[model samples]
Target: MKNIKMTIEYDGGRYLGWQRLGDSDKTIQGKTENILTKMTGSEIEIVGSGRTDAGTHAKGQVANFKTSIDMDLPTMQEYLIRYLPQDIIVKELEEVPERFHARYHAVGKKYSYYVWNNVVPSAFERNYSFHYSEQLDLEKMNKACEKLIGRHDFIGFSALKKSKKSTVRTIDEISIQREDNLLHFTFIGEGFLYKMVRILMGTLLEIGSGITALEVIDTIFESGIRSEAGMTVPAQGLFLDEVYYN
Candidate 1:
């Protein structure tokens, strides 16, 4: 068997998320697997570095799968490009060691949440960005990010009812930048809880808009309560920018 690795990019506007549902083809993983199955003449399941939630796009998402088909990467790439849905793109493909599992071997991930902070919204970016027509205090938002940028019990930021695994994760960085009317919030971390990035974005938006105190990040960390954070922002604004192995 050959272990294949690939970088995937997709516009997650119409899918039910990455995980394959029971007989549902409206998912990135399901769509990709279906094509792989057709190529291999057997059931083929690929493992992603992580799941990008529904309506969340990806630019450099990673995945790996074991295939016994005696095929070259170029031929496989051409096959996928010609057969898979238009929105999904296999950026690159290569053969790797059999032990390289995408999710298990992942070292870090980078996610970006985009906000359109303009008086008027863009007609093209409606599906890719969150529109908030209000002034945000970037200085205050940076302050909150400082408190959030370390290893901590992020049980409060997560959406799980109860975590079977540890909620402690290290956030290597979180920073914001503005260009024209767009505000980009980038998050780099070891790993994130379910919906944690969205939830954290919501909290920062509230703080940046002065709806919540900047120090609330500290309070949420201490309280370990989900309600202490702001609303879970919409998934359309989130993007899985990259997954790191080292």
Candidate 2:
């Protein structure tokens, strides 16, 4: 058997999520599996590096699967491109070591959230970015983000009472910047809890709007309570930028 690795990009506007759901419903994994089953004539399971939430986009999501086919990498990639839907594309494919696992071997992940800070929304960006009509204080948002940059419990930024063994995670970096009317927030972390990025964005937005005090961010970090954080922003604004692996 050969282990195949693929770099995929998709617009997550219509699908439920990346993972395969029941009955092979609308999903990035389900669509890829359907095409793979047709090409390989076997029930193949592909493991993604991460499962992005519904309506969340991706630019460099990675996945790997084991297959017995003897096809060349270029041919397999070309074939997949011809069959897969337009929203999802296999950018590259390679054969890797047998022990390579996309999710398990992942070292870090990067996510970016985009916001259109304009009076009116752009039609072209409706599906890709979040629209906010209020004026944002960029300096205040940056100050708030500094509180999240290092290792912390992060319980306040995540959905509480989840079935996870631990809510403790390390955020390597948190950056907030604005160019023109686009507000970009990029996060790099060892891993993340459910809706963590979105919730963090909401809290920062509150700070930008002058509704939440900048010092409150530090207080929330100390509290480790979910209620101390801001609301979870919409998933449409979030994009899984890339997944790092060794």
Candidate 3:
């Protein structure tokens, strides 16, 4: 069998995330698998780098699958583009080494969150960004981002109730930028726990709004209590920007 790697981009507004569900076809992985299975005339399961929550988008999501099909990469990609839903597109495809497992081999990931901060809502960008009306203190938010950088237990910032695996993850950078009425937040990290980025965004927003003090991050780290952290932001604003492999 030959291993094939694919880079996917999806709007993710109408899907139930990336994983395949037995009862539903409303998933990115399920849709891709269905098309691949039909093309290869065999059962095909693609392994994704990671799962994005429902309504979350992706610009550079990666996956891999093993297949005995002898079709060339271009033909296979064209076939996928021809049949797969317009919202989900396989941007790139190539034959990969047998040992290249998408999830296990990922060394780091980058996520981007967008917020439409304005008194009036946007018609076109409503589905793509979170609409926040209140004024945000960027200086305060940047200060909070500094505190969240580096290695720390992030159980308080995630939705995970329990896990034997360590919750500690390294956040290399958190950048906050504004373009007109849009606020862009980028996170580069080794790995992130479930809902960690959304929760972190919420905390930072609260700090910016003066609803939560800057010291709350230190308190959450010390307590490791989920309730002590801020609310989990909506999924529509988050995007899985890229996955890095080495």
Candidate 4:
């Protein structure tokens, strides 16, 4: 068997999410698996680097699957692109080592949340970004972001329920930047809990608008309680920028 690694990009505006559910709903993984099954005539499961919640886009999501066919990498990619839905694109394909697992072997992941802070939201970006009419203080946002960098218990930034064994994770970097009417928050971490990045973005926005004190961010981190943080931002504004493996 040959392990095929693929870099995928998708506009998540119409899918249920990345993973397949028994609800028979459309999903990114379900669509890919359907195409692969038609090509290989066998049931195949493609392991994804991570799960992106519904309405979250991806620029460089990774996945891997084993196939017994003799097709070359280029040929497989061509077939996948020809058959898969238009919103999803296969960016690259390569044969990887047999033992490689996309989620398990991932070392780091980067995510970006976008906000449009204009008086009127752009029609094109309405689905891709969160529109906030309030003026934001960039300096205050940056100050609050400093507390998010480094390892800590991120319970306040995560969802209420998680099956993961631990809530402690390392955040390698956190950056807040604004260009024109767009505000971008980028997060790089070893791993993340469900809705962690979204909740962090919400807290930072609260600080920028003077709804919360800058030092309150540090307090939330230390409190280790989900209710200590602001509301979880909408998933539509979040994007999986990249996944790192080594």
Candidate 5:
């Protein structure tokens, strides 16, 4: 069997998340796997680098699958593009060594959250960004970012109720940038727990709005409690920006 790695880009506004579930065929993974199974005439299972919640987008999501078929990469990419939902597209595909496994091999990932700070509605970015009319202090937000950039037990920031696995994660970088009325938060990390990025963004947004003090981030860390953090931001504003591999 040959292992194939594919980089996909999708507008997740219309679909369920990346994982396949019995409840819906609108998931990105289920749709792509169904198409590939039909084309290859075999049961094809694709392992994604990670799962993105419903309504969250991806610019460079990665997945790998093993197939006994003899088709080349370009052909498979073309076939996927043609058959999968219009919102989902395979930008690149290649045959890789049999040992490669997308989820396990991924070393890190970058996630970005967009916030529209304008009062008026954005026609073009309406679906991709979350609109918040509150006046945000960018300076305060940047200061909070400093505390977020480091290795820490992020159990307080994650939406996960319980886990036997370690909640510690290393955040390489956290940056907030404003371009006009749009605020972009970039988070680069070794790994993230369930809804971690969204929860972090929510806390940052509260700090930006002066609703929460700058010291709250440190307090949340010291407390190690989920309720101490701010609300979880909407999924529409989060995007899996990129995946890193060694």
Candidate 6:
């Protein structure tokens, strides 16, 4: 069997996230796997780099699958594009070494959250960004970002109730930029827990709105309590920007 790697981009607005569900075919994984299975005439299961929450989007999601089908890479990609739903597209496909496992080999990931800060919302960006009409102090948000950089236990910022695996993760960078009325927040990290990025963004937003103190980030870290952290922002604003592998 040859291992085929694929880079996928999806709007994710109408899907039920990336994983295949037993009862539902409205998932990215299930849809893609079904198409592959149909084309290959055999069972095909693709392993994704990670799972994005429902309603979240992805620009560079990666996955891989092993298949014995004789079709070339380009043909397989073309077949996928022609048959898969218009919202999900396989941008690139290539044969890779058999040892490559998408999830296990992933080194890092980048997630971005969009916020519309203006009082008037844009019809085009309504589904892609979080609209917050209150005035936000960008400088205060930047200051809060400083405390979030580097390695720390991020359990307080995730929706995971409990895990035996370590919650500690390294955040290489966190940047917030404003373009007109849109605030773009980017996070480059080794890994993140469930809903971690959304919660982090919510915390920073609260600080920017003067609803929470700057030092609360440290307090949340020390306490590792979910309730102490800010709200988990809506999933529509989050995007899995890229998955890194080497």
Return the candidate ranking by lDDT, descending: 3, 6, 1, 5, 2, 4
Per-residue lDDT of model 1, residues 1-246, tens digit only: 999998999999999999989967899999999999999899999999988888999999999999899888999999999999999999999899999999999999999999998889999778888998878989988999999999999999989899778899999999999998989999999999999999999999999888999888889899989999988999999999999986
Winner on TM-score between 5 and 6 is 6
Task: Flag regions of model 6 displaced more than 4 Å.
Answer: none
- The whole-model C-alpha lDDT of candidate 5 against the native structure comes to 0.92
What are the root-mean-square deviations of the candidates from the true structure over C-alphas?
Answer: 0.9, 1.3, 0.6, 1.2, 0.9, 0.7
* Residue 218 displacement (Å), model 2: 2.4
Best by lDDT: 3
Select the stronger candidate by TM-score from 2 and 3.
3
For model 5 the local lDDT of residue 124 reads 84
* Pairs that clash in candidate 3: none
Structural similarity to truth (TM-score) of each candidate = 0.98, 0.96, 0.99, 0.97, 0.98, 0.99
Output the TM-score of candidate 1. 0.98
> What does the lDDT read for residue 87 in candidate 3?
93
**Clash tally, candidates in order:** 0, 0, 0, 0, 0, 0
Considering only N, C-alpha and C atoms within 3 Å, which residue pairs clash in candidate 1?
none
- Looking at model 2, residue 113 earns an lDDT score of 97
Compared with the true structure, what per-residue lDDT tens digits does model 6 show for residues 124-150? 998999998889999999999999999
Between which residue pairs do clashes occur in model 5? none
Q: What is each predicted model's overall lDDT from 0 to 1?
A: 0.93, 0.89, 0.96, 0.88, 0.92, 0.94
- Tens-place lDDT digits, model 4, residues 84-154: 99899999998999999999999999999999998898898788899988888888788777778888888
Q: Please, what's the RMSD in Å of model 3? A: 0.6
Clashing pairs in 2: none
Cand. 5 TM to true fold:
0.98
Relative to the true structure, candidate 6 has a C-alpha RMSD (angstroms) of: 0.7
